[model samples]
Target: MSDYSSAFTHCETGNLYSLKSLIDHVDAQRLGEIKDKHRASLLHYAARHGQTDILQYLIEHKKMDANLKSENGATAAHDASVCDRLEALEYLFHQTELKSNVRDERGDSPLHLAAWYGSYPSLKFMLEDQRADAHIRSYDGSFPLHYASSHGHSECVKLLLKVAPDTVNGQTIAGLTPLYLACHMNHLEVIKILISRGANIRLKDEDGLNCLHAACRNATTEVVGWLLEKQNANVNDCDYSNYTPLHYAASSQHESLITYLLNRGARIQAASNGNTPLHVAAEYGRNGSCALLIEAGCSPLDQNVQHLKPSDLAQQNGFTDLSNELKLRERSLIHKALPGSNITSVTSVNDSVTQHPKTSVVRLVVRKKNVKRADVSLQVSENEIVNEIRQQSSTPSVENDTNRRRTRPFAQELQAKVLEHEANSRREPNNSDINQNFNSSHDSSQLLHSLNSINQRNQAGKTRAKLPHDVYGPWMKNLDPDTFKEQLNTVHAGLRKVRRNSLVQQEKYNSDDVHVSSAENEYTLVDTSNSENNDNTPVIEESIRGKEFLNNQNKLTSKTESFQSKSGQNTINSGPKHNQFTGDKTNITMPQWQKELIERKKGIKA
Candidate 1:
């Protein structure tokens, strides 16, 4: 048996003498019994290596079966055709009773293998001389043209298309055509050949994914650009799940392809399950894609159908830095959206206060220079001013009695200053007693100086206040009664809505078991645990850490269930599978046919 194995090796090297010497040691019947790991006989090896003389001697003298199949059902002719061994193939077909169209275990005939291996000479000879059936489908329901196109064998593809032109658009079991395969593999010339021969670019697969979707999924930038620019393929074409080419590009994490698609009018906000490209990028933890989408004006606050934002997705996926960046951008956008005047300076009112070291005195100074009225300088505590406004508005106080007593003196002093100014202004300007009273004492002298300064400021032209009037305004004077009521209602409604959302979030955090909604279950991967801190907010564990926790929980739950069931009672499982909470939906939840198609595009055997 060992000697017979060496005969197979000799057949491959075309060493006829060694092969014959080995065959003499073994009985002739033993030759038929020996095969390699793939069940390939000496004739299969000889034909694969183009050893025509050895093939002839094995067939004519040794009476080896030319049509004998290996484990994969491939005969000597199939082997020869795949290796481009035209001479061996010619001898086997002409001198023996072998057939050209005999299929292997995968239902692939010699013509399919020849086309798949890019054996241009063997494929041409088989098609021109042997009249091989080009229309025959493999087990995958793909014709020879599909194999040639997918492998980027332009010559073989051209030959197959010329013989059977109708097969150019023929699809496999997955609904993938020759043009779609060519685009997926980025075979530009083959794609061009197929299109010129009337291949439809608009054709989609069973999942409703078009050639553009296939190209973007593989990050075939050139093919994508050509399809969009040359063929006019729809950049916003949606799949069965409503995923556009932009969504596929984002999932691929190819920044350049995403940018190119965007420039070609790919909709950045195109939604799948209400998730835009930014959401997909965030879920996959694709930092570059997220940045690109953000730069292209995608809002981080855009929520999916599950009410999950991009930042939420990023945080769930353990991209802490990316999540924080998205949150910061969201804040900046909201700040910009607010109606406000261009501020000269933004200083906190509390920062302006100074306390004396030797005395119990605090000085609070607020000066506004560009006001429509006189430039005012006030020396009063900010707390006292707030209290005064609150008192005037009749608003309920939340401050302690001690704090109220502390602010009373400062508020009284502010009111006294205002009252004095009003009284002095009411006096007749030409009265001699009033003039004397102002000039008699040092206090009068100080008061006269302040009046002169106020008069000078009044002579200067008035300027509008720098503060935004839209937000802090005299609403009763500026707006009609109906408009004022409407604006007030809007503000109250917004506050109520915010309150509701915060309550919902709090509830979700406090609960021991968090069950995701059906729409969100497909995408949520966060393992939220209640924090020990006083805030009561949930701490989101990283995805990897979450998976470990879920795995431990699952193991414990399974053991408990087995024990309970062994005691003659049925146990209801309470833990979800590790896969349920983890894995990217774009890749993990994709259909099996699409996965196989992707594998084929990457030149991987399915």
Candidate 2:
């Protein structure tokens, strides 16, 4: 005889008449004895079919495994819930043997499937069954509320929250709460509901952006106004790069948002990396934004990292009005703002190299004008470590010692020229030295961020002297690829060590040399002489070393954290997989419905 499950499937799609005629000819006891290879009874197929009448007949007579999902994770309940038959789903929910938390391979329960499909009545009924886990996030890290909020199902959102208000306030893997998603999608009513229920507006997502930022990205002007006004959100709150809304609005060219922000007292002159809005506007060719910033009191000659006024970037990009205005301003202040930092002076210091007689490690030498050095070490503050890293990143160190012998005095001359310009209020050369190879240079933002961290760590108890690349080219002649990798790792590790040390220092001295300073935001590789014996901060240094060793072994021991300055955007696993609800991205945890359906169809064929 055909299997009982196959017979039950025949009964569901209105094939019952054909199956029963055969059943009568066979023994009733024999029919009950039939099973699939794993013992799924005939009734299991009837419930799995999701046809109410057929499922009712099976439950009444056959009493099958109401929750029999295969080795891959489907059950009779999975089908009823997915197919949106509230009556059948409710029946399965009431079954004594059926488990409420039976998860598919992707970890979605019936509630996720029901909520995602806008199966409202079924969803509510499931929740009423006490069988639904509303808090159960799908493999993508979306709870029922997130799914409802993202899809504009206001009624579903309200119900799910009442069932689980915590879900509404909960963040998904992507660091966005239901409130942020609702606002991002411009669901005003839903947002009103969430807010009224006490959703956090100041919540920063996985990217370190808040609801206001999301609203800007979506260009929801009304939402923007509401968040800024209702929540009293800081429109000037900086993101991962210390960029305020004005920075983004200027970049995005949202005239209304720009205008609104201006009226509300947003600082048009707020600079990230010392770049005024006018400078940023010029970088992206934002002519309108430029005019707005100019009209709103943005400084025409605000100095950028290159020490060039906003006009410099404008002219570089061929912004005529901006350049002309800057030029006019330049003529007016030629005596006060002329570029004459071309004079390089090489300091011929005769200090003893007692620290590392054989190696030239870049050491921190903090001296302010004439003040005696303080004994503050790595136990310094986070701000100090961050600043020190920035300064040291400029110093050159390397396995290549002779490269310095060839380039030394000249590099020192450039430093002197820079200092001279700083002292005289004159501009230094905006471009890097054309003649120097600039070994151990930090050009990219990623490298600069790493270097920035090292500066902060410099104040910390000194770490094991890192393998500095003050001289990479001339010294090693033929550097080992392995050692080269190790040195690179060490550089990053050393940077972390420096930051960790300084983070522990006196917060009062944190800003002493916070070298948030950069050149055109470009960091040229530097050379330094090894001097003092190095200090060790085991936790900080070991973390870097261990990470590097894992990277060398071709296995990621852990993702390197990337805290963007003025923002905590470290690529840390602030992902959903870590804390379930507080990380970034929905972290789609389970398979999609279509794939599951396809697999089910394939199994029938098999």
Whose TM-score is greatest here?
1
Write one digit per residue (lDDT tens) for candidate 2, span 234-259: 98787775667777677666777788
- What does candidate 1's lDDT look like per residue over 1-606, in tens digits? 564667777988999988887785655467777888888888889999999999888888888778788998999999998889999989988998888878898999989999999999999888889998899899999999999999999999888888999998898999999999988888999999999999999898999988999898884688888888899888889999889999988888679999898888877654546688999888888899998998997877566656667777776777766767776776565445432424334322122211111222223444444443221222232334545555654544657556557555754555566567657745533333443333333354455555544445445634323456666666656787899899888976675554444333323322333332124322233222333552644323223343454364443332223222524543334322212322222111222232344445546432
Whole-model Cα lDDT of every candidate shown, in order: 0.71, 0.59
Superposed on all Cα atoms, model 2 deviates from the true structure by an RMSD in Å of 37.5
- Name the 10 consecutive residues with the lowest summed lDDT in model 1: 348-357
As for candidate 1, its clashing pairs are none
- Residue 147 in model 1: shift from native, Å? 1.1
